[model samples]
Target: MSNYQNFPPANEDGAASTQMFRAFVDEPAAQPPTAPNEGRRTGVIALSVIIALVVVAGVVYLAMK
Candidate 1:
């Protein structure tokens, strides 16, 4: 069996092994950063507002006829 599977590698001289361990453990976890959907969201909102206004105007025109 591999030695590291049983125990952490020795840091006998307090140098290389320790640096390697720190580099492995202290490294930040990889993450997929969230992206802002500002443009798409704004376009969707504008389209919804226009659709609502058109529907309201159509209803008003039908009621006035």
Candidate 2:
């Protein structure tokens, strides 16, 4: 016998309760709107490019030593 069962109390057979339950279940769930991160992404890309450029310069300087 499976223990995972959800049988709501059979004693709760009121008309008002039934209507309230139906109304609750009929509504769509709300979702938060997503914000664009274009500026942040550009900033991160610029930082990565700067870091890569610095690493290449360091490597060239060491190689010339």
Candidate 3:
């Protein structure tokens, strides 16, 4: 009538398998690497602003003429 009598014997191999599965599940994920050229974005933004200013200036000059 006892619950332990109904269960089968524990295997050593099953214990090792469970430990490996738990370690794999609990491990933290790796972060992605940062870009080496992040500073280049500022240069691109400055270039875009300069181009926009030149276009605006050209339009103003034509209107004045």
Judged by lDDT, which candidate is best? 2
Worst 10 residues of 3 by lDDT: 6-15
Counting only residues 3 or more apart in sequence or on different chains, how many pairs clash (N, Cα, C under 3 Å) in candidate 3? 0
Error in Å for residue 39 of model 2: 0.3
Give the best candidate by TM-score.
1
1-65 in candidate 2: lDDT tens per residue?
87998666787654568778888999888888765887899999999999999999999999999
lDDT of each: 0.84, 0.87, 0.84
Task: Give the runs in model 1 whose Cα sits over 4 Å from its true position.
Answer: 1-34
Looking at model 2, residue 33 earns an lDDT score of: 70
RMSD of each: 8.3, 12.3, 6.4
**Whole-model lDDT for model 3 versus the true structure?**
0.84
Candidate 3 positional error at 47, Å:
0.4
lDDT of 3 by residue, 1-65 (tens): 75665443565553478779989999999899998788899889999999999999999999999
| Cα TM-score per model | 0.47, 0.46, 0.46
Superposition error at 25 for model 3 (Å): 21
CA deviation > 4 Å runs, candidate 3: 1-33
